[model samples]
Target: MSAGLLVAVLLASALLEGSGWAGGVGDGNLRLSVTVNGRADSDVRPPEVRVGTWVVKRYRLLNVSEADLHRVRVLDPGAPAGSVRCPAVLPAAEEAECTARFRAVAGRHVHPVRAEGDVPALRTRLTATARAGYAGVAGALGLTEEVVVATPGTGGGGASAIVTYTVTNRGNLPLYTVRVEDPGLALAPGAPDCGGRGGTVAVLAPDTSAFCRTTVRLRPGTYRSAGRASGSDRATTLGTGGERVTAPVLTAGASAVFVVREAPVAPVPRTPAPGAPAAGSSAGAAGASAGAGAAPAPGAPGALARTDTGTGTGTGTGTDAAGRPAAPAAPGAGAAPGAVPPGAVPPGAVPPSSVSPGAVPPAPPPGLRRAAGVDDEGFLGRVRRRGREAAEFGVATTLLLLLIPAAVAAALLGSRRK
Candidate 1:
């Protein structure tokens, strides 16, 4: 009977050890642990991540109970579907591994991973939390420049131009202490009003723009100008322990041409005097007035000179009917002839000098003189014209020499035939 009892005790101990119930009634338990970016959740400090970057999460599910687990699954609510993968079955005293991925967001984030499984006599569930801190430190800047030109009107003033600088934050972070500058252009007093901040922008948000404007007076000419913008990322400055980190200076350029022309002057009208002969009247009235011994009106036909038909006692004006001053009387002839002779001077002969000294000479005929600055040719134009003439002359000379050879050959052939 004692031997049988010892055999039974050994058999019971083997059964308990095989069933994993030796420590007591084996309980169904699942323990879940998570690691973020290779850092365990039990670490003193959370994992660090940059905003907009991918975070790798590793999950480990261990079945510590004596009962085998079935239909085992791991899940993270924040992660997308199919991002976490693991085996469906877990045996007693066995561990399973899973992986999940998610994008890090701004600020602190709490990620919870849970494991669930079904046992023969009990259901098991476990939860774990992984914390991460994300920082946004990347920044980008953009700049653009525009110019508007205004010309002077009839009212006299210099040409004016308005220049505008547009500063843009192109990154995912806020930019601080934004400044814009233009070295090639002089700004007006109290100029560069960037949102009334005078060329400075306190804060510029992502994907937004700010405008800076200044006015300048310019002469008539062409202008080329460029603008530069610079700013620092707020998060980057703080993350780097107060070490200032600035974005690359952005540059934009624009060119424009301006011309200010002088205004034209208007002419004043002239009023005729009272009781004067009307302009463009018939010549018969002028002759009748002269026959009546009345002096012709100024600016009337045949009003320049007059001669009397009475006896010649040198009482008549020494002028001909055609209004030309008479030539000197012939030798032995009277001082003033009775009637002035016609056809006195040959054709093309120059008349006697009638203009006094210090009198301004009459302007040359339009057909004989060219107006100043009208159809004028520059030095280059003259050079091109002379070159063309020389080319033509050379071509003519070559043609003449070729014709001479042909003519001589023809003449020689004719002589031989004769």
Candidate 2:
């Protein structure tokens, strides 16, 4: 091999051995030079030396400038990237400082290896968030909600309004099943369905979403609605949200609340039988006549308001007993906080308060230890050792810094004569 090629091979071999990559390094030697700002700092320095099975290069640096030279990095292009920190602070008239060099490491296998101290030209960063919820689907294939409302109909008891519920998974993580907790909400044909199998979704993977619907029955008075879910029949409540004036859930855990209201039936107007007066016919007529007798007599329920025995619906704009549009019902509990009033859960109703306020995850693993580090310098300027490597590598690298400038000079001077 040519001098350059031989030098490369020897250096590579020495490194592998030193790193324990090889069992032993046979004797080998080759030399190279060092330059800083175009000035040759080290004359023919040993370019490559095999200690065992690996190769390495030894060179030095002499910071003779007036200012404190700070590059905090080893200028190695063919190495696993490394950093260099000058401790001597190169005082204006101080002698040269020193450092040595090694060839490379397996880190080169990683794409665009930055190898510490060696800053890369390109860098990237990322962030993410995750949440698990009841209404959300996990890996489910086909589950759906079918809102079915039963209400007071146009003339009698029936569906007053058609409320559609669309349950969906809009966050990361999957949900296996969405239990029915709302008193009135329910999953049709067996908890809606995920594919053909009901229960939770099969896989509500990250970024995956599913939608289901359920109908709600509404009545005259204001009522709240809320529900809780469970993964299994015995599982405690997993999540909760709902509205007010709602009925208590039948079961303690994973039950839904539905509301039912019946308009007070009014007594119908009665005309006396053609020949015989009905039981209260005479009394009813007398009361009406008496109320009109004076300026609608001081009091008496707006003239006993002929209680319309008919189903009394707040006509048109659905107003209230006072003829005012019932102020929109407070949002139901857990209905998208802030948007819907929380549904009321009886004292012993909601799933036994599933989660406690204070809970924390476990600590990290050994492999996830903090990066190798140095601690606060003490009063004497001695760096506090972080761990084992700090003690060994820290000292070795320090000595190399001290020997750099001298070895470099000797190597160059010796080379000139050759």
Candidate 3:
């Protein structure tokens, strides 16, 4: 063969292989058998299906060829055909099986499926059918409210009350104009959807939903509100659709209690105006006696100094050597020069008069003197006493524990004698 002819043959073979056709097209070669729910011609057809329900179709591929089959695949009507279960290589006199699954669409319709593959050098094709039906559109709506009371001192800004309503398409068919309505809030005219697009949705798939949010400024009181949703069910015949059937209006409501309290008041500090005279001075005193004046500014040194100076004026108390006011003395009281005050003793000094009548006094030659009624042994004596007490407690505890068994034995003996 010429080189060009050989290349043409190779291209044809590649196309056939890519298409996954294995056996010859005519009968007496590879055969194809299709079944729906395991019955080719049954009294009952496949049951009706809603959106999202599965429509299952099984396919069996048998190889009449004496050699193994390769490049085998099952093709269905829809893109991404469901799942296939078959061995790559089909030995002679044996068969391989696969399943094609289709998810129900929004309306009644028929879906066609087929399989094609190459056994060895020949091409083969098999066919099957699947049907899906819808049960009309129905829906349910629910509304919920979330309320948060503002904390004291946090006057405003955050959302205090929020109402959310969900519109769900519970029917088998797709829905249109899915929107929520609220008596308390301003919704878009002609029923506005949650997306706030101001236009109806072309299609809301079955078992799906949309959420509408409305916010309100809640005062310090209880709140109650109601909302509802509306939508139109889609109707389709054959391959055409878009006919709308009005669905029943769904109503829901929510109630929330929002509370707010008055903010707290903080005391303001008083500041003396600039050029104002110092407090508690003659000017401050004059201002006070006039029945109109602010109190002395707190923590001012001048105010404290004025108060201390005022304590000595017009009083009979004399000033001490330290310049502090002295305590008043009795009428006949007299003191020698450099003498300490009565009833006051120098620290760590012993007074002669404080000694007991018959106690022997220490000689003056010794710098240190022994005090009466002082315990010489002191801390050591206390420690020895504590140690003796601890030993007695240990002995008592040991005796008690040792006598318990003896007491029990004696009780048994007494009972036996009885």
Q: Candidate 2 regions off by >4 Å?
A: 1-167, 170-199, 203-208, 212-222, 229-261, 264-272, 275-418
Q: Write the per-residue lDDT of candidate 3 for residues 293-391, one digit (tens) a residue.
A: 443333222222111221333444766668877665432124332333344433455444566779876553322333321235488876886799899
Pick out the ten consecutive residues of candidate 1 with the lowest summed lDDT. 236-245
Scored by CA lDDT, what does every candidate get?
A: 0.62, 0.34, 0.50
Over 4 Å off, model 3: 1-28, 33-47, 53-55, 64-68, 79-82, 101-109, 121-418
* Pairs of residues at least 3 apart in sequence or in different chains that clash in candidate 3: 20-117, 20-118, 21-117, 21-118, 22-117, 22-118, 22-119, 22-122
Of the candidates shown, which would achieve the greatest TM-score relative to the real structure? 1
- State the lDDT of candidate 1 residue by residue for 107-156, as single tens digits: 44554556777764533333333333223334567888788877565545
Give the top-scoring candidate (lDDT).
Answer: 1
Which whole-number lDDT from 0 to 100 does residue 220 have in model 1? 57
Comparing 1 and 3 on lDDT, the stronger one? 1
What overall lDDT, based on C-alpha atoms, would model 3 receive against the true structure? 0.50
Clashes of each: 0, 81, 8
TM-scores across all candidates? 0.39, 0.23, 0.29
lDDT of 2 by residue, 117-218 (tens): 111211211111111111111221222233334545344443543333233433233444444334444424445343444433443443455433334445
